[model samples]
Target chain A: GAGVSQSPSNKVTEKGKDVELRCDPISGHTALYWYRQSLGQGLEFLIYFQGNSAPDKSGLPSDRFSAERTGGSVSTLTIQRTQQEDSAVYLCASSPTSGTEAFFGQGTRLTVV
Target chain B: AQRVTQPEKLLSVFKGAPVELKCNYSYSGSPELFWYVQYSRQRLQLLLRHISRESIKGFTADLNKGETSFHLKKPFAQEEDSAMYYCALGGGRGSRLTFGEGTQLTVNP
Candidate 1:
């Protein structure tokens, strides 16, 4: 079965520019997540979506960070006016539901220059 | 707030030697703990969860409420066991996880 897929394996953009990272969860998976991994750091939870439930966005570092999942399958994380601090690997994951083993993507390395 | 701490940034053990990766966590209530592993060039994956109370690939972990710890252990480490290990805490009904900085294990054969 296909696991979580993230597009744009790597991205380099200027500061203040907007960037959108995409994620495709496994077929039938109802839970999706976005996380950030800085250099030599742990995974920072960003957002979560489970079924038709309200998504959890408390982990977003700032208002510039936002995400939306359409049709409960594909998700996109948008960073408005990206900062150099946003340079990190963006990871996406999906599971059958909360508490299940979540499958992760290879991650998209975003570099805000 | 929930947090997981992996004190050791790196661990090295010879093949066939015992290995233990320390993990400590803090949460006000009953917490769910997990171990996630990522090999070089591979995606991160779940290694085990404390609730399952099951061993995978000769590795096991026991959650200690008294100590607020969930350390991973293996009787004899193998070369293939070398990888980055992350301690995570799953919180609330959403199951969002708080992770540690991760420890890179090196099994020298």
Candidate 2:
């Protein structure tokens, strides 16, 4: 892809339901990132991936939130037993390497009702 | 841990007016700072980075190590410059990027 791509531009799920968000980073990019954008909290870092391994997952809010990247390209973020507080826009970004400028996707707006 | 802070949530200015968006970060190690902007209905994109010292779209940012600040500035603001701006900090290799709360700038005509 020319830029980072995220699927299901918008999503609505009920409490206790599970939701999956996807991200397809630009070809040959080795670094990927995930973030959550909320009303006042701003962009909260959720995870970071280098190649197919995630070295930084400290930003994951809770045990319910998990993510994985495969083939050093596509990534998936899964939220189990979603809560209303989880309503926010999930953003994905990719960079050629660590410490470089990142390109972001349109983001996936996840609304948990 | 590295953290970025953007104090202003909203900023407004008239066209051709000078504008400055403040950004501060706290990190023990040398950090990489960047500014990202998102216009209405568009994806977030990198505006400039402190390391490059290059200006984009008339915007420039300087990294002050002593003050731990990387503020974005423009002499004359244009209406097209209206957007949400974010300050980000990177902790070098194998580090994750941390973003600030963001500042929403509105350059009115």
User: Of the candidates shown, which would achieve the greatest DockQ relative to the real structure?
Assistant: 2
Indicate the TM-score of model 1: 0.87
Candidate 1 residue-wise lDDT, B19-80, digit = tens: 99999998886788889999877889999999899999999999999999999999999999
DockQ of each: 0.55, 0.69
lDDT of every model, 2 decimals = 0.90, 0.91
TM-score of 2: 0.92
Model 2 chain A poorest ten-residue lDDT run: A50-59
**Alpha carbon lDDT at A1, candidate 2:** 65
Per-residue accuracy of model 2 over A1-113 as CA lDDT, tens digit each: 67889999999999999999999999998999999988644677899998755458888999999998887889999999999999999999998888678899999999999
Candidate 2 per-residue lDDT over residues B39-68, each given as its tens digit: 887889999998899999999999999999
Worst 10 residues of 1 chain B by lDDT: B90-99
Output the lDDT of residue A28, model 2.
93
- Cα-based lDDT at residue A26, candidate 1: 93
